[model samples]
Target: MTEDQVLDEFRAAEALLEGHFILSSGLRSPRYLQCARVLMDPRRAARLTDALAATLPAELKIDAVVSPAMGGVIAGHEMGRSLGVPAMFLERPTGTFELRRGFRLEPGTRVLMMEDVVTTGLSSREAMKAIAAAGGTVVAAAALVDRSNGKAEFDVPFYPLIRLDVPSYAADALPPELAAIPAVKPGSRAIA
Candidate 1:
């Protein structure tokens, strides 16, 4: 799907939120993409993931798909379905990503790490690091929304359905406009 189309879906689903919100990455933004809401409809989810899967190069073989849990589970599962691969999730059992609950990869297994939204790409990079530590190769990373605005970097190639340049601010350096508004933590992860 085109960026505009994806954005339209977000709007139609009421997933594109506007408020003084704290992201999972600990940054504050006036806008947020609540992908769980967007991906709630199976048909819309399938269509988006299918389009996301189509972006992968034909030569790249994805052995398995792994995603960071809670936020990414459903979206990654749908993407895995489109790619016809096993889908698994990484949990933070000890405050960091891990292949817990018997979910794993064989040595040299090609993995496609996915997420619902990527702000600073921290979660994706953490999951990739864990996957690498467990003997898997993260071939690439994909996400439903990239709120990083094209600035976040990852160890693997990053592919996002929509590249949204949302403005964010650090707590100590909030913009005057954003500072005046009350901040709400709407993301799944809690700030430290």
Candidate 2:
């Protein structure tokens, strides 16, 4: 499917959304791209993942696919399956995400990090660091939506199935449509 087609699918699956949402990046926007809406449908999810999988070069030699927990788990599994590699997800423990549950990346393992959406690339970076700490070499990063306009900082190549120019506003800068909604701070908080 084309980029436009993928975006159209995202629009069609709007039921997964709720009241004004503060993205993980701490940016305030009137809308949110709830990937679960598209991921819940196996057929559609396969199609979308296939499109993303095609962008990855065969020579990258990815040994496994890793993604941040919550939103990215399913997408990572789907992409890994499409690429015929094992998949794992990193979850937040304390204040940071780590490879838990006996998950370990062998030395010199080539890993590709996958995400459902790219806002500030904070979570992606954390996942990359974890992979590196485990001795895995990050070959690339993939996301379903790229809203950062390439501003995300990552040492590896980053690819998104859809590139969108969605601008975000701060709490005080939110438009009238979003001004009435309650504000929630973004970031992965630690549980004490």
Candidate 3:
């Protein structure tokens, strides 16, 4: 799908939006892309998954789709279905993402790590580590929206369906509109 088309769909789904948001990157932003809004629509979610699936090379065989839990679950499932692979999700346990609920990656399993949104790529990194520790080989990383604009660090090749170059503000760098808003740190691990 064209970039404009994808963005249009995002807007249509009211997923990409603006507000006081604490991104998963520990950065404060006035805008937030609530990906669940888009993923909630099966057809729209499939369209995005199809687009993301196109980026994978035919030679790179993916055994399963693994994503960090909460937001990435549905997207990962859809992507896995599109690629004809099994889907798994990692949930946080004691400040770290681990394969819980009897989920195990067989040795030498080729895994693709996915996220609903990529800001600092923290969750994706943790998911990669867990997969690696479980003896799974991470082939690539994918997300529905990559707000990092390619600045985020990752060992594997990162792929995002929609790259939004939206501006972000730190606690002190917040805009006047957000000046009165309560501060919330952004990071993959949200300490409730």
Candidate 4:
């Protein structure tokens, strides 16, 4: 899908939120993409993931899809369906990402690390590490939205359905406009 079309889906789903928001990485932003809302509809989720899968290089071979729990679960599952591969997720019940609930990957199994939105690439990196620990090789990474403005980087090939240049700031350094609004955390991860 074209970038505009991709954004249209978000707009249609009302997932493109505006206001003071705290990202999973603890950064503050005036806007946030609530991917959970976008993916809540099964048909929309499938459409998004299918378009995402189509963007992958034809030469890329993926054996499975692994994503961090909570945000990535639905998108990852849909991605797996799009690619015709097994889908699994990593959980952080104890502050560390790990494969649980009988999820396992054979040694050297090619994996596509997936997420709903990537802001700092921290969760994606953590999820990739957990996939490695589980004997999966993360061949590439993909996300529905990348609001990092090209700042976040990954070792593997990275593909995002849309790249947004949304500005984010530290709590103490928030812009005056954003600082004035109450900040609400809408992500799955909590910051201490």
Candidate 5:
């Protein structure tokens, strides 16, 4: 799907938000994509994820789809279905991400780390580390939206359904317009 089409889904779901927002990365932005709202509808989630999965290189072989809990769970599950692989998730019950609930990967299982959005790529990196610790190899990663604007980097091939150029700023350097509005955190993770 085109970028406009992808964003249209978010608009139709009312997941595309606007306001002073604190992202999971601790940065502030005027726009935020509330993926939970978009994925709340299973059909929309499937459509979005299927388009995202299609963006991956055809040569990429994924044995399983492992996503970080909360945001990535639904997208990752749908991605697994799109790829015809088993889907599992990592949970941070005690701060650090780890595979639990009888989820295990073979020593060299090829994994596709999935996420709802990639802002700073911190969560994606953390989740990839946990996947490694659990004996899976994260050969590639995918996300529904990449609001990083080509700034966030990953160790593996990264594919995103849409790349949004939403501007984000550090807390101390927010634009005057955004600074005037009270910030609300709409992500799953807490900022320090």
Candidate 6:
């Protein structure tokens, strides 16, 4: 689908939010995309995941799809379905990502890390560590939206259906207009 179409889907689901908000990265931004809202619709989620799957290297063999918990769960599942592989998520029970709940990746298992959006990409980086610890090799990473504007990076391939340059600011450097509004924490993680 086109970028406009993808944005239309987000807007239709009211997932494209605007206001003073805190992101998982702890950076403040006036715009936020509550991807969970868009993914709530199975059809919409499938559409996006399918698009993401299409971007994968045709020669790449994926043994499983893994994602970090909370945000990446749904997108990972949908991507797994599209790729015909098992999908599992990492949990942060001890303040670090881990492969829990019988989730195991055999040594040399090829993995595709999936996420809803790639902003600062800290979560994806953390997920990679867990994947490596489990002996899984991440061949590539995929996401529905890349709000990092090409700033985020991964050791392997990174793909997204959309690339958006959403503006973000440090806590003390927020724009006066955004600072005037009461900042809301809409993400799953706590502001750090």
Question: What Cα-based lDDT does every candidate model obtain?
Answer: 0.89, 0.83, 0.84, 0.94, 0.93, 0.92
Ranking by lDDT: 4, 5, 6, 1, 3, 2
Best by lDDT: 4
TM-score of 6: 0.98
Per-model TM-score versus the true fold: 0.96, 0.89, 0.91, 0.98, 0.97, 0.98
Superior by TM-score: candidate 2 or candidate 4: 4
Q: Give per-residue CA lDDT, model 6, range 97-125, as digits (tens).
A: 99999999999999999999888989999
Off by over 4 Å in 6: none
Q: Which has the better TM-score: candidate 1, or candidate 6? A: 6
Stretches of candidate 5 off by over 4 Å are none
Where's the lowest-lDDT run of ten residues in candidate 3? 183-192
The superposed Cα distance between candidate 6 and the true structure at residue 87, in angstroms, equals: 0.3
Measured with C-alpha atoms, the lDDT of residue 136 in candidate 5 is 98
Q: How far out, in Å, is residue 178 in model 2?
A: 3.2
Cα error, residue 132 of model 5, in Å, equals 0.8
Ranking by TM-score: 4, 6, 5, 1, 3, 2
Q: 67-149 in candidate 3: lDDT tens per residue?
A: 98888999999999889999999887777778889889999999989888888777788889988988899989999889886
Clashing pairs in 3: 24-187, 26-186
Clashes in model 6: which pairs? Answer: none
Stronger candidate by lDDT (1 vs 3): 1
Using lDDT as the yardstick, the better of models 2 and 3 is 3
Tens digits of per-residue lDDT, candidate 2, 51-138, equal: 9999888889999999999889989999998899999999876667789988889999999999988888988999899889888999
